[model samples]
Target: MASTVIAVLEVTLSWLFANAKGRDAKSFFTRPALANFPEQSITVTSPDCGASGSKLQVDYTQDGTGRFPALQWSAPIEVAAQVKEWLLVSEDPDAPLPTPIIHGIYTAIPASKTSVNTDDFTVVDQAKALMRGGFHYGRSRNGLPYIPPRPLMNHGPHRYFFIVVAINEELDSELLKAETTREQVAEAIEGKVLGWGMWVGVAERKWE
Candidate 1:
């Protein structure tokens, strides 16, 4: 019985040590920067994307059912003819260490739409139908579909950023057609942006 107790203790210790190490590693990762752009400059708000209702909000916990809230600006920052493409992205600056985690990337939203519904991130409909069919917001790896992965432990309140970028030219029809990496979408939209709007949301998991 003593030997069994010792074995159980060892197992428990091992698990605790591993969890500590993982948390430590996560802490080492630098979180992404909070959105500095002003609210008046843009037209949308999301709870998961900002500190308040007026900003974009990103829920840290992926309930598998909760969708990312969306806000829309009243007008396009640039004319449709000047826009080459549209891009949407979400980043958690608070993510630990090596890199900030990218929660979502969507390319090819048309310039015409004034706003996207929060449910638009996952649902297929007339609004999404207007954009390039392949590149909708909140797509996950392997075309598996997106499900937010809420951290088990809230590292304070993490900021979730949502950006809508209007680019100058259609850069990557090939990759966009093939389903490119989130990084690729970023790369394609770099520098060519005519205008961009952003929102922020805060999330922290509560321990009971």
Candidate 2:
């Protein structure tokens, strides 16, 4: 009886807290690590997403219900050549847990003779598109997209980083034509990096 009463009290307290804040009590309890993020020299922006911008949406899960925002960046002139086989990597350094989360990885942007203006998400031409098979970007388990059964909550707000790397040589057009992993793309660009840039955004969904 005593334990039952304690449980009831706990539930009531949680309920009150949830109502007081406009979020779930559990969400309120979680500590989002927005402060301890790594410093980056480059600046990133998304013309199609963010509260102040165009606000394009990104679905976080396979159910396609919850969505995050789509992001883009402005490429500087020095990094333009490397953009041809560019690799965009997003990572959270300060996960509440040990291992950092890799939120997104996109590759194979067109090499820009000039700087890429903001709002350029897709490759400019058919030839520059990441080959259909291996180049598509998303969360994949063993190279296949599999949505998790249970959501990983309480992880705090994850920092989504987008990095652009310039490659030295033209990748194997035949291998790229067949589709390749971002790792392979990185391998192709290993020696010839000209310049790189990165930007970050924060996101998290906690249960109340």
Candidate 3:
């Protein structure tokens, strides 16, 4: 009974303090490590979520399959030719926290690749993915490679930024493992980032 009461209070407090007008991924880039990276002409799109600034489908969030959505992207000819690898980060700056809540960290993507399907990132199929690629995954806040959006109930809309970074140098393989943290990924890419692009998808929890 005591634990139950505590859980209820925790939920209530979170709901009460939630910001209805939450910030988006652009705010996330203001951090010192990322502030210098130029915004390049990379086109990132998702068929599952329509387009940037569009509402994310339930199928990609905690409400449904919770799979990482399929994504496609292209870098400029010069950038592509120089890029040694690509890094993808998904996070929610609107989350009621001091820092954005990281949803996923997928790195070491081959420079030759331009797209990824759900099969390439669904955590359940990670073993299969390892057999087919040179890419690696970094642990999210929940200790998994991906955590689908799960905004607090009544917290209004939360934007999930799928930020794709083009890196001129290959990230240290040691820092691209399952135990790696977001800070580590940021550190690994600090001066190596050539540029980046982003796609934003919004989700909100209206029901408990």
Local distance difference test scores for all models: 0.50, 0.41, 0.76
List, residue by residue over 1-208, the lDDT tens digit for candidate 2: 9956655664554444432322221220111211122333234565434432131233533235433334444555555534455545544443433333444454544554222332233333445443322343433223332221112343444444445555546556644431344445445555555555555454444345
lDDT of 1 by residue, 92-152 (tens): 6554434446676666766666566555654454333223333454344434334364533
Pairs clashing within candidate 3: none
Error of 2 at 16 (Å): 26
Selected candidate, larger TM-score, 2 vs 3 = 3
TM-score of each: 0.61, 0.51, 0.84
The C-alpha RMSD in Å for every predicted model, in order, reads: 8.1, 10.8, 3.5
Worst 10 residues of 3 by lDDT: 124-133
51: Cα error in model 1, Å: 7.0
Highest TM-score scorer: 3
Off by over 4 Å in 3: 1-11, 20-28, 31-33, 38-40, 123-133
Residue 172 displacement in candidate 2 (angstroms)? 2.3
Between candidates 1 and 2, the one scoring higher on lDDT is 1
In terms of lDDT, the poorest run of 10 residues in model 1 is 27-36
Ranking by lDDT: 3, 1, 2
Model 2 pairs in collision: 24-208, 25-208, 26-208, 58-68, 82-166
Q: Count the backbone clashes (under 3 Å) in each candidate.
A: 33, 5, 0
